[model samples]
Target: MTENPLKAKDEQPFVIDPIADTGAAKWSYFSLTFSLFYFFHIIAKYEQYTNTQLISVFVIYICFIALFFQAIRSTGKAVLKPIIAIVILSAVGAAINPGTNALFGYAAFFSGYYFLRKYAVLLLILNLAAQISSALILDLLSPYYLGPSLACSFSLFVYGIFSQKEYIHSCLQQKKNQQIEQLAAIAERERIARDMHDLLGHSLSSLALKSELAEKLANKQHFEAAKKEISEVASLARQTLSEVRLAVTGLKLQGLSGSLQKLTNELKNMKFDTQCYIDALNLPPMVESTLIILSKEWITNILRHSNGNSVSIAITTDANNVTLSIGDNGKTAKIKPGNGIEGMRSRVAELSGSLDINDDDGVKLTVVIPLLATVRSNVKNKAIVSV
Candidate 1:
């Protein structure tokens, strides 16, 4: 079954592995730094330069701050597009009016948003490219030196690319996990459907058919025989009802062996020599419940209709499927079609398994289940345990 989405195991609450944690931490740090730099830039830009003679410092400072924010934000595809657009727009504005400080300030804000909101390498690259392009296009000196600006921008771009790549990989991993969980959940639901049908349907149908026969006989001359039949049907109904209640109540959290033991006891109390022989096989809660319900209904049928004196049940693991067979040394009459039996057939179909009921000397019911339906490794292992 799928691990609980909202509730994790009590044994280990925080199960995020090192790689996942590292990615999250990296993203957080990137966002925080960008936020701080954005604030610092806003304050710095508003202040009047005390010494406007050395104006290159203003241009260089603004370029670094904007580059820092945009580089971090472009680590993911979601924010990469917007950041790239801003970078291009800023570069164009800078080229048109080379000496304007307003374009530099604007570019820095775009970098900050890209860094904090998304992980996209392209955003960082575009921002640095804009800075380099602007420096070359708006060179105040007669001679232009584009080499230094290009080198600095390229280095920052490379760093942002690596960070973005890691972030994307992490997201892909999480998505895969979620898909696996969803598949598990779908399988579990199918299993439950099959189990309920097998357990409840068979018992009710057998009881109903027997009860009808008893009523018919009562109207005829066989009054004693009719009463006997009616009594058996009544007992079957009561047992089935109890089993249904237990199956529904103990479904989510109960252990497999324990649920089976309860069923065995209930059957024994009703004077059916029901011997439960489960191998050292542990199963998931859902599988256990399904088996328990199936057992209850199967045994009830044997007692009421099969005229079986002793019943033996055996469960074993055969590769991926848990196989169960219930055999009895009782006489079998002509099997009649009923809703209960039909339901059992349907339930088995849901689990993608087969259920066969045979009557030669006595009635034998065999069930084949997939191993994936059960959680085996965690199950408590024990030899033959009887109740």
Candidate 2:
């Protein structure tokens, strides 16, 4: 038979872990032991019952205990069947012995945990009705008996609601953590890919240019010039390999000042006027690395794409933020964001930073990153340790 959609939706699947299950079962059994007093009460009033009645009571108690263990161990939708059986068994056991009415509290607790709010309330009310009807039919109602039974059942049901909410909250938190981990891994992979492209793209282009020059010199029978070109190619290859190694190891051979100087020299070699400024401030390794890469990327873009012969680069820091601004005298009507721009944005965003592109006079890019608490703490700790 097919299950009811409403009932199926209301059920919570159990996680089966050996250690967790063992701990839960241990607590449950400890609590169940308290119910033994009811059995003791029955035995104490032995003179008021026949042998058949005692045997029936003992058999019912044993079966109820077995079902209770089953309910605790059961997983998934199967748990609801055993829980429902538990409720029925508790009602029957109460009819047989009014002292066993406490069993209804167990039923109410499980119902609240396994069922949705409305259904759990319905089950609690039904169990209470069953308890009252059984007590009335058997003429076993007492001021002491009914009040405590109802109160315990309600109290446990409320506890069950709280426990259910806590469990669901924990599950959501776990799922969120997993998603964050997965996203971090994806971002790392993208970062490596971008780094590789940036590192290799310029070097390979230089290699190709030098190789072509060497071939032309050889074709022209200028052995000396060709030899010189080949030597430069070999040196550039070694430098590229070293940079790749540094990228892989997540290290930078030069700090921000040194890297900016190298970039400015490169622009000068290309016959472009370059102005550069760097503030003397402590920077975290990640921020330094990101700025270095972005400087290289922007400089490369300027060399390859810009029409202007002048470029300006500035790095400045305030109390709360560090900013990098790069602009060229190249004329541009509109700015188009491509892979390089996207990569820069991604890198800046990872550090909770922002990137802006403006093209009013020439293409300009600005990156601003906040000195977050952790970064500031690291700077402070470094100063302390250095002192």
Candidate 3:
């Protein structure tokens, strides 16, 4: 039994954390300045240089800084213009002062990381073209320096491209884990609630019926019969107390079939296009209950978060193994591994099973449990429901 993934009492709502990273307050500015800072020493040696020459260097550096900052801040289509402008302006500067080659390389690094991969490579090519053209025209393409420069710059470009993607994926994975933790906690709480209800519901119902009969018998002056009814009520109370203790200790009594059948009807009522494919292999009690809870939580997540129109679930097993897979065509790329997912994983691990979640076009989860040698069998029974 899983608790509802909703507010119970004063529990705080789960919130997706902000993903934007603020590593440096003035990253773009510092990067541009440091990359060109070494070249400024060269300007001091040009004896024929006038005020205009120094001013040209300062003005070019300032322009690249502004453009680089803008390109860094903007994303997608908004960045296209600034990046192009920066590349062209850097080319002109490189023609005047070969030192601007460093600026061009740094620009290439950022472009490769931020832009679409195909477009990023194109920008890198443009940067190379400008650098080679400037070097050739100035007769300054020395093998000693050119070899190292090209190797280092190209490496930065490639590294930036891959590392940024990896970083984003890592961030997304962390966020997913947080979500799963939150959901799993909710499910555990819900499980406790269900246990309490099941333990008390039947016992209380029986208690009420017997008490009413006892009252009627007493009013009719049937003292002996009323006493017997009273005694039965006492027995029920004692039994109920024992059952409550078992439930509180996490001894769940609900079976797999009962829960699945109820879930199928619930999904139908909620207008979900759901299909269930179950096998009839007389699953072990523990395995059956675990799977039932997993299925419920999985479906609940779909209905609450997947925004999916349809879902397909399949359960199958071999001579010594069971495989269960559930998939939905929905925007699940953003779904994080919340508490519910974590709880499911922990339970499956205890049963010597594995669970994997794939996020491609949608969400698909596959769970495999290796049956014990004593429990493994070859019989097949399929229970499928589609609506």
lDDT of 3 at 131: 65
lDDT of all predictions, in order shown? 0.56, 0.74, 0.67
Q: Which stretches of candidate 3 lie over 4 Å from their true place?
A: 1-19, 24-33, 41-46, 143-149, 182-186, 189-193, 220-387
Model 2 poorest 10 in a row by lDDT: 378-387
Model 2 TM-score is 0.55
Residue 194 displacement (Å), model 3? 2.3
Candidate with maximal lDDT? 2
lDDT of 2 by residue, 191-218 (tens): 8779999879999999999999999999
Better of 1 and 3 by TM-score: 3
lDDT tens digits, residue span 1-387, model 1:
433221224422111111223443455445434323323333545454344423544554455456534443443343334345545654554443333323333333333322422322334455555676676667732222234334434554454445534544444545554577678667766776777899888988898799889989988979999989988987998898877776565555345566667666756776778888788365654565577678777777765765556778888876688888988887857677588878877776777778987888687889997865223422211111110
Tell me each candidate's TM-score: 0.38, 0.55, 0.49
Judged by lDDT relative to the true structure, which candidate is superior, 1 or 3?
A: 3
| lDDT, candidate 3, at 25 | 23
Per-residue C-alpha lDDT of model 3 across residues 1-387, encoded as one tens digit per residue:
333222224543211111233332244445555565426545656675567877887788788878876766654356666667766776577555656656666666666665546667787887777667766776768763355446656987886677556544545544454567568657977988887887688889999999999999999999999999999999999988977765554424355656666666667777778888888468865577678889889888877777677778888888778888888878745557878899999999999999999878688999999887423322111111110
lDDT of 1 at 100: 32
